[model samples]
Target: MFDYLGGNFPTIDRRSKKQMKDVEMVAQLLLFLEEGVRAYSQEYLDKAFSDRDISWDAKEEVEKEFCNTVKAIKEILDLSQDINLSKTRLKNQADFYSLFGAIAELNRENEKLTITRDIGVRINNFLKLVGDTELKNQSKDSLTDYQRNALEYYEAVKFSFTDAGTRKTRIRIMKSVIRGNIN
Candidate 1:
């Protein structure tokens, strides 16, 4: 992760366990943002498609709602201050994890009104396109360029979440994998 930062830095000792845990917390925040984007985007798409004719007002409204929700999520995970100070909000790691679990449950309950299953199918199709022959045969440099363009298009036109909704779906799948829940 630090390699992605792109700067010369002095060598440091290996991270402590606490530092690793902090990194995990940051990872969770990233996951939440990713799912939040998907959920909000899907909400916008659903509104756009609900009527036979797409209304500019409806599209703007959806965009407004999505922006607001994303702002709220960012506030909840604010990293502007020292992370050690922020960790005081949750008494322990267990509490922190449980908070995400509760949030996932709440997100799941709220997703019944949306067409997540259909969206999931669309997302699957987009993934298949990304992995098709052209992508598979490309040189690494060309593949990187192609993937960036393709993914941008995919996100703009085809991104979606599984039946469980974005946030809850990721949580559920992670739990399932951890628990050996595969069929």
Candidate 2:
């Protein structure tokens, strides 16, 4: 938060509602990045053939959607003087925290999706080894049903681990900024 001028001294305006709104929007963007795009890609991959290649064009489309959503949410954070920070409109730090609650929910979902993909990879590897005489002979009960099923499930699913934990931490840090505890 920056204040343009106050004599020779630069001023911090952390308590301003506008800044908090920006932080909230950033948090939402992070959540979406961590969850939404991954889910979309998974849905697409699940329907496609196991050996099929996901085109760069399709990847670009998902990226573009993410970018567009961020840009749209940024309007809430633009901090224009005309925008009102009324109490009813998430105009404070607590409201921002509430927004993070939503973010955490999304983060949880994203983690689940990641676990799905990891299990899929393990399953595929195990399937490959099944045909190898030496590997099959070494272990009959090595892979659990859960692990075996995960590979089979891979045919219908994909997952992405969008790294948004850093952003979540930043959102929490933004609180101290609101309270004038950070420079």
Candidate 3:
């Protein structure tokens, strides 16, 4: 974006010599930012779209108020700084600490889900390996039906994921992630 906007890129459309004006480009970029935010966070999108066509002044306020980025963060989320001070329900954005807290909460939840998904994949691979071993040994028929059924039953119980044992494993895995001891 910097290179293109700075006129450093050699590539340009041959069909049209005219490029978008600054205002048009800003509006398009803001719209894209809103769309991208809406995809991930409905709460942020609701706050962003609450105002009936937010003015440039509101955008300027966000740009000036927030840290880390210039207009990029402002484009994604339009916040009223005054409203934030008022403790209003229409506060455009949560404080940085609050937002980070929410992200940390989400990270834990996602970690649990990721661990469960990984375990599910491993269970599948284990079943395949066991089956292949039996086939290679030509010992598939040696095991009684009950033994084979027990192996299948173990798979079924583990794969249920909602079962007590699986739930415990999920908790353990989540804790491990928090401790930075993923294994």
Candidate 4:
């Protein structure tokens, strides 16, 4: 649904029929990555909280999970362009809604993101909890199944995903999530 540049679709300079097909394949692969980004965000949040050795919402730690599938696709496709426009090859981004990538969007300027709707509400009753820091020193918080999966996937990626191909890693993680086999 999205690419890197403006957080929109990828633009392709008509290269070859083969290149076009490859781009199409990359597009399909990236489509599944939206959830991967979400899972990564969840893992990031959980790790940040756990490593703190205390319960506190650090707004600075909150960040929207985003993917640079465009670059990955470019690398995968081995795309390049000469200094002159004569050799141009790839272009993307007719439009993009950057906020769509955020787990929670407070407004046009708010940068607070959440792992999930339930966690966001638990952290704060407000629609926007990012950077609010009202979180108390609570003991073990209940995590959703998605959150658990995200955490498990994080550990899996840490070990098995090391030195793997980026595109393959993304697809593998997505498949694990779909199969509920992240453990």
Q: Using TM-score, give the best candidate's number.
A: 1
- The candidate with the higher TM-score, 2 or 4, is 2
Residue pairs clashing in model 1 are none
How do the predictions measure up, each by TM-score?
A: 0.22, 0.20, 0.20, 0.19
* Segments in model 2 whose C-alpha atoms lie over 4 Å from true places: 1-57, 79-183
lDDT agreement of model 1 with the native: 0.36
For candidate 2, write residues 26-137 as lDDT tens digits: 4334434444422223443334423234443344544554444333223323332233222222333333332333333433445321122322233224334323445434
CA error at residue 169 for candidate 2, angstroms: 21
- Candidate 4 lDDT, 62-106, residue by residue in tens: 322223323323322332222221111112111111112212122
Instruction: Give the Cα error of residue 31 in candidate 2, in Å.
Output: 9.6
Q: Rank the candidates by TM-score, best first.
A: 1, 2, 3, 4
Give candidate 4's error at residue 179 in angstroms.
Answer: 13
Local accuracy of candidate 3 as per-residue lDDT tens digits, 1-183? 324222221123333225533323233234332232112234443455456256444565333322222222222122323222113210111121122122233343563222223332332333343244353444547755433533443343346533334333333332333233432
Q: Specify the poorest-scoring 10-residue window by lDDT in model 2.
A: 1-10
Which ten-residue region of model 3 has the weakest summed lDDT? 88-97
The C-alpha lDDT values of all candidates are 0.36, 0.33, 0.32, 0.30
